[model samples]
Target: MADREDKNAENVAGKFYVDSQCIDCDLCRETAPKNFTRADDEGYSFVYKQPESDEEREQCIEAMEGCPVEAIGNDGED
Candidate 1:
């Protein structure tokens, strides 16, 4: 599970976040391009944007589910 304490600094303030456990696998990025993006310097992924629509929320959920390192987390915020 992703640890909020370890959440990537680049992640936007939101319910969803990516943590330092991320392995840069590109799964989240490919799964939810709008929300997840690469931190080129750190070689990890972070949530750059919060979902704005039902479809985007679904995509973010999918990305969270697909993260290989379990680095994605949903804090259940709206």
Candidate 2:
């Protein structure tokens, strides 16, 4: 489970976030390109945007479901 307290600094202020447990995987980026991104220099992923539509929201959920380390969080404030 992702620790909100340890969420990545690059994540925007939103319900979706990536915590320090992220392993720099690209699955979230591939699954929700509009909402997730990577900082190659930092070797981590973060939520760059919040979902704006039902489809986007589902995609973000999929990304979180597919995450191997459960680094993605969707319960934070918007």
Candidate 3:
């Protein structure tokens, strides 16, 4: 599970986020490219955009569930 407190600062203000535990895996990015983006300096993936449609949200959720290190999170704050 991803901790809100430990989530990456680059993450956009939303329900979905990526934590510091990210291992720079491409799973999330591959799973939801629109919602997830790479941080070149840190070499990690973070949620850069919130899903607007159901399909997009589902894709984001899939990416979160598929995260190898469980770095992705959905706290439903947005």
Candidate 4:
């Protein structure tokens, strides 16, 4: 059960959630395509996968750093 929960959370990916604070800047997608994607309807960015490679992990960290609104993080736990 705990493993399942962890998997579910990993599937959701990232520590950040796009909120009303998002400006649809697409920076996250640009920084990490494998991890972040644009939502079709909302045009906001979301994490598609937890980064597996060093490069990808760096990309996600960069996306978080580059967020204009600082909307990205470990779901505010950071």
In model 2, pairs of residues that clash are none
lDDT of each: 0.93, 0.92, 0.92, 0.62
TM-score of each: 0.96, 0.95, 0.96, 0.70
How does candidate 3 fare on TM-score?
Answer: 0.96
Instruction: Give the per-residue lDDT digits (tens) of candidate 4, residues 1-78.
Output: 012222222236444444445567989888888887766676566666767788987887888788887656554332
Most lDDT-accurate candidate:
1
For residue 27, model 4's alpha carbon misses the true position, in angstroms, by: 0.7
Displacement of the residue 72 alpha carbon in candidate 3, Å: 0.5
In lDDT terms, how accurate is model 3?
0.92
Estimate candidate 4's alpha-carbon lDDT, on a 0 to 1 scale.
0.62
Worst 10 residues of 4 by lDDT: 1-10
Off by over 4 Å in 4: 1-17, 75-78
**Candidate 1 TM-score, true structure as reference:** 0.96
Which stretch of 10 consecutive residues in model 1 shows the poorest summed lDDT?
A: 69-78
